[model samples]
Target chain A: MSPHLLTLAEAAALIAARKLSPVELLEDCLARIAAVQPRLDAFIRMNVAEAEEAAREAEAEITRHGPRSPLHGIPVGLKDIIDLKGHPTTCHSKQRLDHMAEADAAVVARLRAAGAVFPGKLATHEFAIGGPAFDLPFPPARNPWNRAHHPGGSSSGSGAAVAARMVPAALGTDTGGSVRHPASHCGIVGLKPTYELVPRAGVFPLAFSLDHVGPLTRTVRDAALMLNVMADGGQDYTRGLTDGLRGLRIGYVRHFHEKDQPASAEMAAALDEAARLLAAEGAIVMDVTLPSLDEFSAVNRTILAAESSVVHEEWLKTRPQDYAAVTRRRLLPGLFLPAVDYMHAARRRTQLLARVNEVFADVDLLLTASSMDEAALIDDEPEVERTYPRQARTPFNVTGQPAITLMSGLSSKGLPLSLQLAAPAHAEALLLRAAHGYERAAPWKDYAPPC
Target chain B: MTDEEIAALVKAAGLEDTAARYPADVRAALAQLARHKGQLPRSSDPTLEPTPAYVAPRP
Candidate 1:
């Protein structure tokens, strides 16, 4: 495999063993970017000189002082919404075309301290909401599996870049499934950790209550490795990664996709197969129920719209034309929402959180379909609009729990299908354990996007 | 909400141009938000407190 195609764990181990050089790894990534970028449109900008310089410095420092951490010298991309000191965090929006970061966002500071190299800022939906939009300053990222398809958003580029092997891992923020949505569609591992586990101090806010910072990587273990750096105080998220699913209880929320939203036959079958695989692996898998998907969607959308409106209120009033039509339309409703409705949604959210928390008493983790269908064509507006809201990923976001999306199988058209696993708040270790176990037992992780 | 109501809301929010430019989108968004409100239960446990706007890190 090319150096750029190596998982973060594989590359980190080689770099630590002195068998690989950070500079070489970075150069390989740069070369991959050059080859795939025109087709994938994954990055908003490239920080080549700085990344190369940083890689050289890391190589020398490691030669003298050994590696600082697993992320040492790993080349990672930042979603353009994240600040990187002097770089423009354009957020793939023309509204903020010239906006530059005065300081690194909290997560960026942590990644820098971990010795990760920044290849560039990856594309995001306009302010992480209005895209796969063509009218944005930057072209929307296309799926690496098939350039004609949408890679999912608002973490579009983060997923595409990682899946294409242009970067082993990237930072993505999830508000109502942005991270997991892209990860599912692009066939990668995306984790939206327990809310607030990673600080959101520096990234542009979508919904203050729903926003989460996470990693999109090629492997479950790599996602865990990235979390270790991204998590506050640098937790060793990879510690219990190898714990198999024997005796582990998994709650399969089949109705969320099967009946509530009624996913495509392909997605439903893939989910069932994933459940059977886990059951075969000695996991005590059983059907579990949560509130209807519509209930969760309502609560999530209400909170998201209200909070996002607050964040963009000033701009919406002064420069409404600056936002993409989708973003502007989505945000405009929040402005007109009665204060009572926002309060009611807040109260309902608390009730919903308690309801989900009750399910943890029965199972170690919950499994469901990440996206209802495979990647739709980038310009297929009707399909995009139809499928965009048909997801199980937002329920976990509403509950403020940790959740992960990983490949489960492929659709008939050769597109990736994904399964999601969510654990109670701060139970990322358990969540990852279940996902990692399934990833090993199943053949999904072995397939790579044909970029 | 009716189109007139949505138009009024847009005008009040200083987004008349936006409403004119993307009338269908603006109406759809408003209708969705209204639907979300309709989905809320008529009543809830008065004891249930709302989630805090900001949660401090646990020590």
Candidate 2:
């Protein structure tokens, strides 16, 4: 069996048992990328020589000490926004295509220390916002499930790569649902750790206050393993709460599904079945109300627009023509927000966080459909903005809490359905535990798209 | 904001470049913001103090 086709945990076990060679695994991955990348376009940049050299070093390490960690010989794809020492952190934008980094981002440094092999930089939406575009330096990634559907963005390539089994795991960033949305659509597990839980020092900033770094993998256990390495000192995710969901309080934001925007029948059925299964496993499930989602959307948009505008102001001013039309058009509004409005948005976020805290006082986690609708066909809509909601993920970003999306079931059309689990501030351990428990019961973790 | 008023805001915001191309979407978003104008209380209000949630402790 190809090591590239194994789940991250499976590959780690094989490496630990000396059944897999890091060099062999790297060759398999490079070969698979050679065969599949032309069609999927998931990778943006790759250096065969460097990856081969790293593989040789990793093989030597495994020979001497068995393995460094679970990721000792694992090959993982990094989103382009993350800085790798001596590599360009292009951010999938022409404006920053020439920007090179002198050092790895903190998380990248940690992953390298853990002995993770990097094949190359993965594709991302333009600057992690305006994308799934063709006008950029690289082509947008195609959905592995059906090359015709949107793979979701801006971690578009990361989701597609993992789903296609090009790599067992990949790093992704989420700001307003980028990672989880793609994971949900692509039939993979995506975890967005609590804000600042993973240091963002070397990442290209979209919205400083809202951007979160996370992992996308094939299973909850794999995600857990990845998180163990990515987590900073402040986050302790090894408390072993993930073994069981027994006696955990899982809150369902039914209104998010029942009222805001109705989900497909298959999705609704999956939610009910998932809730029942969790309940069958001794977890408490009940309905919960959130503060007005509309207001939440408003505040999140204001903050994202205002902050991203600030980040790109100089570039926008100097070379507005270089940006994708969507970003230039979407980002232009941020420059208009008054200082008072930005402050008010921040203050409203504080209020919303308090309300969420009150809700968490009753439950350990909150659940919602990652996306109310299934993946839309690529040509179904010319303008993608109309198909999605503005606040599906804004609440968690607003609260600075950790959240994850688990592959719950498939739509009638075979597209994936994801159940989103959000935990309290800095409670990623509990979040992972709950997600892991649900995953074990549902067994959707092993699902892969038929690309 | 009215079309004329919004255009002025766009010009002042240095978005006159793409203003006509996406006027409705931009105006709609601004109009959405306009609705929040009188709803939120003043930032100086005692109820609006920063919570420990947004505070990142000095590392």
Candidate 3:
């Protein structure tokens, strides 16, 4: 198999056994990226020179000594919003076209220590907010499954790259389901670690309290391999990968899709089949209701608008024309949002977390619908706007819990369908366990976008 | 919000160009903001309902 097609874990194993060279894997990924990038538009900037040098060094070191870790020599893509020492973190925007980073983001530093290679900066929404936009410095990424469809964002490039087999792993930030959205729409695994689990010292801030850094990979096991290095003093997230969902109580958050927003009939059926599959494996599936999606939507949007406004206020005031029309439309409301409402949203966040905690006391995991529909045409702005908020991922962001979305099935349109899995705060291990278990039994678990 | 109120707010935020260029978007944003404010729990109502088990600080 082409090294580029290997999951991160499989590539790591081969690399450790001296059968696959880091240089070979990196070059293979680069070649595939060159081939697919024209259609997918998944990368903002290609830092090929440095990545090649690092891959060569990793190969020599591993040959002379031994592998440093599973990620040793693995070529991982960095989201454009991250500061990768000396690279322009364009954030797919014109505002930072000339901005250069003097130091690596903390996560980049950790990955460097783990000996991971970087191929380039992946595409993100403009400042991780506005995306698939025509006015940005670069074009929006398209879904690998269908080049004309949206790939999901603002981690659009990350998801597309992984699904297209251009790279094995990529990092993405989640504020309001950016990570999970792409994961869902891209037919891959997107894990938004608990808030603060992965430090955010160098990541561009969207919503201060809601921002989180996590990994997007092709499989749940690859995601585990990713978190082992991304977070500090992490647990053996892979230790429980084989611990299936037997006897585990999974609370089906049907209301989030069934009543709150009414997911598409296909997506709703996919989620139901996923729950049934898990129950067949001995998972105790039962209905669990939280507050309405609108309630969480209000709290999430209020905090996101107010906090993001603080980051873009000066620009909104002085350089409004520089922003994409979509970005401007999204950020302008924050300028008019009453400060009292922002605070009220924060207070409401606290209340929501308390309520979710009460629910967790009775269940080990929460399952819900993600994306609510399949990928839409990239140019269909109205459809994007309509399906964007019909997700269950934002509630976890508001509550600061760990959540992941993975492929549940496919739509009749040949687009990927997904279901979300969430756990209590700091319960990433359990979240991974349940996701891995579900993926193993899922009919679409091994499904990749036929790129 | 009235068009005049939105234009005035846009002008105050130094985004008069935005109001002129994307009036509908500005109006849409204002409408969504109003809807969000309505969904927020009233301060008088019970806001934080922590179960007796334990109430950890917000993650």
The sequence of per-residue lDDT tens digits that candidate 1 reaches over residues A70-123 is 889999999999999989989888788889899999999999998999989999
C-alpha RMSD of candidate 2: 2.7
Chain A TM-score of model 1 comes to: 0.99
Q: Write the per-residue lDDT of candidate 3 for residues A1-451, one digit (tens) a residue.
A: 9999999999999999999999999999999999999989899799999999999999999999999999999999999999999888888888889899888999999999999999999999999999779988799998999988999998999999999999999999999999999999999999998878888988889988889999999999999999999986667899988989899999999999889999999999999999999999889999998999889888888889988998998887777778998998899899898888877787777778878989999999999998888988989999988878888888988888889999988899999999999998778888999998989987676777777
Instruction: Let me know the TM-score candidate 3 reaches against the reference structure.
Output: 0.96
Worst 10 residues of 3 chain A by lDDT: A442-451
In Å, residue A199's CA in model 1 sits off its true spot by 0.6
Compose the digit string of candidate 1's lDDT tens values, residues B1-59: 67677778888777776667777877887777666667865445677667742342343
Candidate 3 fnat reads 0.36
Query: Which one is best on TM-score?
Result: 1
Q: Compared with the true structure, what per-residue lDDT tens digits does model 2 show for residues A1-451?
A: 8878998888888889989988888889888888889988999999678778888998898888788888887899999999998889998898988898999999999999999989999999899988767778888888888888888888999999999988889999998888998898898989998788789989999998889999999988888888889987734464675668888899998787777767767787888888899899889999899876666677777788888987988776667778877666667667777888788888888888888889999999998777877777755545367655622677787788889998888777888887889988777778888888888888787677786
Name the lDDT value of residue A19 in candidate 1: 92
- Which docking band does candidate 1 fall into? acceptable
lDDT of each: 0.89, 0.82, 0.89
Candidate 1 residue pairs in backbone clash: none
Identify the runs in model 3 with alpha carbons over 4 angstroms from their true place. B11-25, B45-59
- Residue-wise lDDT of candidate 2 within B1-59, one digit each (tens)? 46788878877877665555556556765765666555543456757754534463323
Arrange candidates, best TM-score first: 1, 3, 2
